[model samples]
Target chain A: MATVKWPHFFHFSAPHSVVNTPAHRPDTRRSKSYGRSCVEPPSLFWQTPGHLTTLGHRIPTSRRAAKSHNITTKVDPEQVALLIKNEWKLSHVTPLYRFRHTQLKLYSKHLAAFIIAEKQQGVAVEVGVEAGFKVTFSAVLGIAETKEDAETVFIQVHSKPLFSADTPKAVWRGWLTCVNGDPEYLRSLPPDFVSLPLFCSSGPEYLTALVKSWFERTFDCSFGSLYLNSTMLNWLAALWTGCHPTSNIRYLKLAWNMPSQPPLDIAYTVNPQDAWELWNSIHTEDSTDDRINIEEVQLFMNGLEIHFFRHFKIYLSAGTLTKVSTALGSAHHDGKIKIGSSDYITTLLTLLTECALMKTPV
Target chain B: MDEQARAILQRVIRKIPNKKLQTALRAWDHLSSEQLESLDYAQPKWLFLENLISRCEENRLSLKDVTKLEMAYYIDNPSKGTWHAYQLFQAEGDAVSVNFTQFREQLKAHLKDVVRHVSVRTKKLEDGAVWIRIAWGDNFSKPNHLKPTYVVHYLQTSYVFVLNLMSKHKPFLYQALLLSTRHVSIKEAQLSSRSLTAMRDLLMRQYQQVFPTNQERTLKERNAPPSHPSIEKEHAECAERRHQMACEAFGDGVLPKLETAVYKLETKYRGNSNNTLNDKDELFRGVVMFSSSNLLESFRHCVSAGMAEGPVTPLLSSITQKGRNSFVITDKVPGAASQTPAHKA
Candidate 1:
């Protein structure tokens, strides 16, 4: 028989095993039976066959056998690392585990780089990511110190569209790479990150509700002044954020572009108490020092009346008499109230005269 | 008498009714001898014959009576021949003599019946004449020709007459008639333009005697009851004055103003047309065209040379201005007025 050399193995005595026992003695009979049955044992369980074995017995029979037999061979530590790195590159490694390790390292590096780059760029960042979506990548971008110093940066990535759409996983992976590569580039993004569609949206109601929830989640963050254009969305955000109490939102703009006939109902969603609170805040603040201009207030009032007349009436009642008078005068000056009928003109004139008289020093 | 003359005379007598002839003749026969003698001979003779025949036809007398009377008057008189010659001469000179006698007989008969009817109808007016009064409303004036006239007739025993009684003032009568007729209620009887003119004319005519002189009363002065006249006359004058004022005010100027104002109001409010006046704005244009030839002659009757600021002034001015604006005064070509001959020379 030709002598065979087995692969090198490390050996050590069992920590708790007895040295001599009749059961532990080598059984030649069992060994011959095991040889006749060529079926290999499970790789992990294969220890020593029939108590004692020749060196040839320890060696693998074929190349496939050698693969199974080599499991016990002591692997070099550097070689293991190299092997893992190579596997990651091939993408055979599970993406979750790879993401976990890769984002953590990228986050640390980008966080430092973003902090330095944000100082140079006057622009802001807006990051939006939903959970279970690109949130993994967003989380990495959000952690960057440079992204934090941005004048106005939003980071939000919705998970539902990214995961559920027909997009390939590779595309998301590519997005993840782009987002994580540079936080400085993201901070230079334009103010209007998302362009609104020309036509009215069917999903405004849904989007409004989501935005309300978002406003609530982000209430504590320093978002500065928010100008929400949608009437319903702004109203809902105002309610959910609870910023009315503290007046954190110094300026709010609302736009309503509904048709003239069958005017919209805005009172249903807006709370009277919230409106009163907003009006009271406006009154308590010095009119000269107000950040919101009179024109902006008029625009807001116009939108309110257009969308919700009843709510606007209530708002007017809650508003300061001075402001109400000013608004009424402005309305008359603008010819917003059509002077078609004699009776209507008389009624308007009466109301204006009454208001003017009431404000006069008696 | 000639046979033809006799036939014509008989035909005329037949036209008189029997009952009227009987009454007339009896009155004629009852005439006292002194009265008959006091009458002119020719007239008495004609009357006697006419009455006698009329009585016979009425059956109050027989033909014998007519014959006896005629023979006694003609044959018994010795100068009968001369009388006959006078009668023939009168007949020849007058063509209507035969018919005149017959008509006289008929008038006598008619007068008798009228007198009897009046006496029976009005015992109080038996001795004198019974006067019948006729008054007409404004609208009736046009058709009836509201003029007062006296109709007199003498019967054997009494006289019958008809006297038209209306407002002494023509304008008063006209307005009163309009007020009484056109309106359902007294309030609605207020005089309108057309009625006003009629009333003014009526008043001016009717009250001419009371206000004879120009110094008698001016429009405003006449407003008060006349102090110079008796109470009854004063009341009449006052009533006349009021009627006149109403007519003049509503008719002369106010009505035209009111019409224009109503037209403007309708245009502004109701959006309707005023078709009451025949002389609409268009007619004024024709007047202007005619008037343009002799300005002085055209304006001769006009109160002023320049247009007065009145109801029609604005309309006239607007028309005049529009005409002037549209009028193009170009240089007259050599023979523009005379058209060139169709057959070129």
Candidate 2:
């Protein structure tokens, strides 16, 4: 009955301490309106439907349970690269990098808040911070935590802050090589470096390489669990999986309402021709006891259009199904039909029949 | 009858066209002695003379119809200048003799066409008036966008006057009046009864103001009769004064009455419940009524003064009473009763 934790660790820092303290400091003036009061912890953990497991609790490690937990974790370097390559195949990777750079540039002009979350305990912690702050409290906190646990930390010094500022190109080149070329060097860096809110004011591809290198050098891990929000994690996972060529990453959940403006163009990596074949493969592989995850099925259906119906019919013919109507009826009950399809009427009729059978008082 | 009177009568007859003069002579024949006296001829004893002179001038009556005795009667009345003048017009010429005869005929034809067009245009106006009355009763009515009350009022008043005048002077013109009122409801036409009464009152008031009897006249007039010093001048001045006064009184009284009657009728029939009388509609109705009434009165004055056309008295009487009575009867029972001889009689 333990609730699943989102597989992300978040490090948050604001210019002013949001925490309320009664102590008066002459240098730092306090405002009464600064902090919100914390609510009391619930009496029972499982009483609430949406509560996550408490810290230090063991997460379910079974593949099926883990997959259902809404987090994808990778423990191998080859697999991480493969995922990244797959993401690149699926989207226009260049535009993604360009967009990331633009966001960084725009955010640099204001008082910024930064958060970095790590998906795994010992995998290199991800580092990110807003561009402008006189003193980054997060960097200071990391230093303090490192000092407290010096015996457990091993720090590999790559580009110091001064070197990054003075010789940026050289530092960038070195950072890139350390991340993409030398796995051992990347694995040598301390996990605390990940905890430090590092500045990334460049393209997303560069930032991705830097982060991956930092993790490899710091923890000798190619990929552990992703610790970013759904969008970033989806992009990185797709990249690792080699599902697409371009890295224009789209997280299905986040895609519902993203981009303050509508995207100029949207491209899907899944071929319209292959959609029917893929759908048939899923049905053939799935057992009566095993049900298709409705979400993946819906996403697949979203990419299909009228052009795929002919191929889909062919796929249906190849399968040893009783009557096509019965098969479609069951499929329709499962909500597998795309709502916006031109064949909505036909599909809806089939779906109704399927739903009736499923709910036939058995 | 003297030879001079016969020459004058001949001269008058020469001035008038034959056809019109014939009609006038026929009308004269029908008049009683009192009616002839009311015309106030200069020579009373020369009645036959005046009558013969009037007949000789009538263009409508052929010379073969007149006896030598009638011509001899005309020779003796030397002082009957007014009668002679009327005969002159009657015997003047055919339609070609009068400069405006052809034009008048054209005008009549054009007017007939206009009557057809206006019937169509005025349908909405009449309907609007009816609707206003049905909706709002006698309360103040708003002007309609399609047909303003002022225009409709003017058209109705003009139409009634024209009918009256045509029936009196030229019975032929009655056809046009009938055509004009073809589509007008019996109720709508009867509304003119109120207008006619108002007009009669206005004319009487005007006549009294202009030519008051010696008793009712000013002291100055009594002190200095027509025989007194500057008698001719005084008479001229008095007539002028009377005319001015009549004009003013008619303008003030008759015009407003016509406007009020039209407004009341429209309000009783077609006014919208929500709309109230706007100042523009009131001003427009006032101006139109005054102008239309003035036009009719001026035309009547011209006839009375021997300037233009036939007398309007017969036409006015015919339309105002007969037409209005017919409207009342038909309006009372619009269907079966209208068809019955009992109602028609």
Candidate 3:
């Protein structure tokens, strides 16, 4: 129910109306070319220093030495225009274009807000040698709830060092409440107020760097475990090529303390609860007391391990290895697990009973 | 558990001939408990007759009434029955009584001969023929050309032998006639031996037609030619181009224009403030602007109601002096020595 806090001043309804109407309607007098002639180019208005210098105050660009930080880039008018044109074209034909368009707009609005805010702060910026204004997309650390006493925090950029003068006094006073805040509750505050980068002119590589910087900030703030949503996986995949992002984050679900509930039929794969129970029965109580190494057992239960571990947190431990050798029936050895021409029906039945059990307990 | 099943079992066990009793018992033992219970024990004679008939019928052997009546007599009253006429003049030996082995062998020979004589055979269909055929219609229009229906010639005879419609099921019919002939005589069985060879030859021909001569090519490949790789590639390229065109037309063309308009409108409205607008003034202005245009009414109303905007929390601030240069009084934090790199391995 909680909606994103988009800027009220920048009304984005014009595009929505344009999309709602027929694209090639000759009867209606609405500007079919998306008001290209109505609005002046960014070059004309943005060049006026006094009017636009406020954008720098909100986003301090190129604060570090030029060689150390190559982050000062400005948004281009033509590119944005092209981006808009592409979105408009897709909206009419593609089935998913509408949804994608909405997401793009949301992201762009955030980016635009940052640009406006940074400019208002009256800070000086060194536009990079690579020409045109571009912004570094800020990582969303967490969403904060608006309590009565607590003031709403804008897109916060974390500062290094705890108990520093730059750390906001309100953060030390325990005013902010982020939804994705670390459970350990570190006291160090996010010191910088940053603008969201709307356009990624430098590609995802630069975005990856920005993300890495955010991670460093987050880690500096808290020495405890950091919990990230699964959506981060998709973001990382988009940012980096050939580098498997999931590999870096160790599976740490054991600390989550998930709620105990019956598995729903909505899941496409095997039921985790059934798999857990089956594991318990097959391995015996004593064997289960220690952590089950996923690599140690060569069971051919497709997706069983993933399903169980995903839902519930199980700690990995270096303990005595107990193998469920009977169920496997001598097919796989060591790490090499290959499915052979075994009795398919029997194997299916075994998986059904142990992993994907549909029967509810009496 | 039922009396009928028990009676049927007893009758089957007792009536089975001595030579083949062991084999019959073994086959019976393989039956599940449910199958055992389903026997018609009330009419044991009929059950024996049916079982024999089923066995012969399975081999696609057309039978005469004389054969059935004789077979029924032999099964029901095994002690009173004499050796069949076909067995009387066998070159190898004559038998006083018909045993399961001799009866089965003779029956197979006779049925094969009968089928070869009665059934009609035609040249291999070029387009191919399906196993089943009725009135031609859309539902059953074109027979699957992939499946070649090979025929075994059989002689038409006026024999009152009852049978279910099982001509389509060649394999089952073939097996039934071969294993369960009771009334057929040795003379009749011997006379049809030549016809049996012809039946065997027909079956061999059908098998050859069904299977591909070459071993490597799978049935799927044999039935239809493999799709060309170029065609698949072209199809994929076409889809990609279509998507690209769509995105270019809408996303790049129209969407950005609308966004620019929105940005322009925001700047236009905010410029009218003259640095004197309070929260109330801004709210009133927003409401008026929204009322005039349908685009921003929801946003204006939502903001006025305090449904979205919360109290402002400034994380950091710097002051810009009126007369002198702007001084950053807020950058007081000591910098860290170990800065995390922009990219880490």
Across B235-313, the per-residue lDDT of candidate 2 in tens digits comes to 6555545444333322212221321111101111111222221111321010001113333344233333332223232
Encode model 3's per-residue lDDT on B182-221: one tens digit a residue: 2222111111111222222222222122222332243224
**lDDT digits (tens) for residues A1-362 of candidate 1:** 22222111101111111122122223222222122222322321134444332322322111100001121133333222221111010000000111233244454344334433432357454445322323122222221123312111122222344446564221111011111112222222222111110001111233323322332232211111111123223222232222334323322322222121112111122232333333443233443432323333343343333322211111222211111111111121111222121211222222222222222111
Candidate 1 lDDT at B297 equals: 19
Worst 10 residues of 3 chain B by lDDT: B256-265
Q: Candidate 2: lDDT over CA atoms?
A: 0.25
lDDT of 3 by residue, A1-362 (tens): 22323222113323554455454332122231112233423332235534322222322111111011111122233222222211100000000111221243354345434433433467554543221223222222112211211111222222223334453321110001122111111111111111111111112333323422332233221111111222221111111111112112111111111111110111111122323322332232233233222221222121232322222111111111111111112111111111111212122112211111111100
DockQ of 3: 0.00
Which parts of model 1 are misplaced by more than 4 Å?
A1-98, A101-235, A259-362, B1-345
True lDDT of residue A111, candidate 1: 33
TM-score of every candidate: 0.13, 0.14, 0.14
lDDT tens digits by residue: candidate 2, A1-362: 42222111111211123342323431121111111112222333326444332211321111110011111131233222211211110100000011121233333222112112222336553355322222111111111112211111111112224324643221111011011111222122222222111111122344345444444433322332211223222222221112212221121111111111111111112321232333442332333333334343433332221111211111111111111111111111112221111111222222222222222111
True contacts kept of each: 0.00, 0.00, 0.00
Candidate models: Cα lDDT each: 0.24, 0.25, 0.23
